[model samples]
Target: MSLSPRFYDLLMKGSFFFVGGLAGSMYATHHHHDNLKILKQDLNILHPPTREFGHAEEKVEVSKDLAVRDVLKYGNPGPIADALARKAYVAAYDRRLRHSAWTAEHLTAASIARPPTTDTSGPVDRGKSKFIEDEDLPIPFRARLADYFKSGYDRGHMVPAADAKSSQEAMDETFLLSNIAPQVGDGFNRHYWAYLEDWCRRLTGNFADVYVFTVPLYLPRLGTDWEMACVIGSPPNVSVVLASKPSSPLTPDVLELSAGAFVLPNAAIPDTAPMESFVMPIEAVEHAAGIQLFSKAVKAAAKPICATTKCELIIRKFDDAQKKPNLRRAVSGLV
Candidate 1:
């Protein structure tokens, strides 16, 4: 899928609002419709009144109908979810799933560039960063560090730490639990997934701007009834996927956009597997996820990303060093 710069601007600013609603809707529709009603009532109570207060002498007793109308004059603001803005990316935290429903980042050569040696805060270092619970989230809604401990899954990043290399603080922000989901470590996160993240970063070399949206989707198993279940402690995160749209200036008044959406199973994907095998239509992704990613005008004018650039992965293995530690942690049931 391809998009105009105008469309990209709109998405970067408002995508999270749609994603947050999508996550809340999925959670409510699948597991808690009744709870949603209660949530609406709670939101009504928590939402500040729009009316201005008056002096005691000027105050008047408003009718119940009038009061209700005043409260809803602008329409109901659905269940409130966390809209997180980090140093390098923005994300919508899914309180019910205890992870991000989706994360968005804009990549460029400058944005992902490594800091200079003379920098005061020091160059971005992944080793110095540790996975931590997002304290900003309510205690009950936060994805605890203990949840992934010994869960036989990696604390997979939706927005890769590599994309935040411009600063140490940027990299550290990527470690927040709000941006993580459970993923198979060896073949998926450490290998193939890392390659995909690298590919997104590499797009900066080809296009002036690369916009990426990472979303975790609960796709139904083939030939089986749709079921949504996750273990309490070790939540089974769903199929993780991302859509990338790169736009370059074609002329002073025109831009060229190319896009592609790829869905990868949370399970390990072999290095030999062709990247094209995972290619999916952008509309399919929107339908399955119940969120519109782009406008029809953008979709109509966009070019297929694979046609614009080689849809291939550059193999780089990190499992040799990580395997032992991951196995040890899995055995000890600790992170």
Candidate 2:
């Protein structure tokens, strides 16, 4: 038996109203919530204020009475939103760092490699860099950096490959020119790299978000070519810099701490030109690299080394024993 025309019309009208109401309710719950808006919410800048550069506003406006909701914007913002949010965050913290008693240890590494020009206009457009993509570093240091990243070096990445390998989008992001650096043998690569990746992931889940970038080829020895790499992302909260001394071509001394090294960026972000203030965080970076670049100094007291004849002989012997793995086929540029 078919329903009467009048009854059918009434049923259709009720269903339409119900669907419309549900849609309207959701829209109001998140988008229209006043507290979620930027203007209404309480903004905290962890870093100290910088007299040189003042604060900038987050344009997302919020109302006084609306309720707040925990919303995650992973894919929603895509890359643009991610960039902007990071910029805003950096602007806040950097100002804070300048004001607080917190002192930043500056680091600079110099290498003179002919740059590879990259054309920005087209697929093959990046201009040929004046310096080579890979620097032909001084003999002593070239052997040293190579030794740092030999087969046993493990191809460790400061910006982890796994994080980028999770998907095509992630993988492509990893390939970005800014997020790369060459490292030594697999020992540190396998163990140390994984530790850092896991640590960053943990920080993301704990902190609202994390912005990171890894600089490649920090060949700071004098007489090497000039090379510079910087990322376009928003600044990070914390920064870690790992450094080592090239004692010999085979065996190098990995310092427990290097004062002037790259920033292990878990939080702090870099913006000022290279000449400006330097940034490095000991704790967060310690977590990222899993190696204390420096040994502990208790009560600001420095430890005295005995430098005895026997001890010195043993140290030299160990350095001499370190084997240099051949990469003649892998790297053709080197003789």
Q: Give the candidate number with the greatest TM-score.
A: 1
Q: If scored against the real structure, what TM-score would every candidate get?
A: 0.67, 0.24
Largest lDDT belongs to which candidate?
1
Q: Least lDDT summed over 10 consecutive residues: which range in candidate 1? A: 326-335
- RMSD for each of the candidates: 15.1, 27.9
Indicate the residue-level lDDT of 8 in model 1.
29
Could you tell me which 10 consecutive residues in candidate 2 have the lowest summed lDDT? 14-23
Model 2 TM-score (2 dp): 0.24
Candidate 1 global lDDT: 0.60
lDDT (C-alpha, whole model) for all candidates: 0.60, 0.24
Off by over 4 Å in 1: 1-78, 221-250, 318-335
Q: What is the lDDT of residue 226 in candidate 1?
A: 39
